[model samples]
Target: MTRTSAVSLIRSRTLSDVAEYAYAATAPAGSRLIFLAGACPLDEHGGTVAVGDYAGQAARAVANLRTALADAGASVEDVISTRVLVASARQEDLVAAWQVVRDAFGDHDVPSTLMGVTVLGYADQLVEIEAVAAVLDEPQPEGAACPPSA
Candidate 1:
């Protein structure tokens, strides 16, 4: 399922039959931008989750991305863009990975780029995702006392 969010997604009407993902996204002013490290398809034990399987690795990568976003006080809905890296020259392998990511984001459909790369850092790592997200900070109450500076 797809959904909209704080980031605005843009699609080109003139572009013919492009992929389902949006072509661009824009975050609003006053939104905090979060830059995340590339999320890898690794299990909690630091082992690659999917050996030689593009789709499986992509799924793990998305889960890792979610964890990273949570750590940064964001979620998939706040994502503004992503770069998907698949370790294969074959288009089908890239598509296999892209399908998993696209579905995971549902309609949030943040702007993204998919690339077939030569290799990734981890063993048997067929997919990785690097993401940028923006989230608005919660408003302070009127006359709210400010906390002491750390």
Candidate 2:
């Protein structure tokens, strides 16, 4: 018998071709959840990188997303959902941005939503992404030694 994992992928019963997303993600019990603010395509100096370049902006935004996750003691693998906003109506631009996001997420296959917008917070910003992650709390084995405090 194949064992099913606790991460349940919920989908609409009547919907077809919705494989790209999970309508709902149910994390395992005792999971620590973190919701990160929207990450923009700004560099460390607070300036947009590669203005007017959708793919470049997407890459920067994904990099910032990784930093945010690391700061919270989480990794991309912990991400359960993501919302990607692109400041363009063109399908090609949106696809370009999405490809960058897919590269960042790797094999996690987390649920994601991509949207096209007229504008964003920054004047030259082309992409913004926000994410939610669930860090599972693994139970320590009985009688395990605790590490010393720093």
Q: Report the number of the highest-lDDT candidate.
A: 1
Instruction: State each model's C-alpha RMSD to the native.
Output: 3.6, 4.9
Deviation in Å, model 2, residue 83 alpha carbon:
0.5
Question: Model 1 over residues 3-73: C-alpha lDDT tens digits?
Answer: 33468888878785476878888888888788999999999999998799999999999999999998877
lDDT of 2 by residue, 1-150 (tens): 322333445676777764566666778877778899999999999999989899999999999999998787677777888899999999999999999998787667677899999999997998999899887544569998753322
Model 2: pairs clashing at backbone N, Cα or C within 3 Å: none
Candidate 1 is scored at a TM of 0.89
Error of 2 at 47 (Å): 0.6
Q: Distance from true position, residue 28, model 2, in Å?
A: 2.0
When summed lDDT is taken over every stretch of 10 residues in candidate 1, the lowest stretch is: 1-10
| Residue 26, model 2, lDDT | 75
- Cα displacement (Å) at residue 64, model 1: 0.7
lDDT scores of the candidates, listed in order: 0.89, 0.82
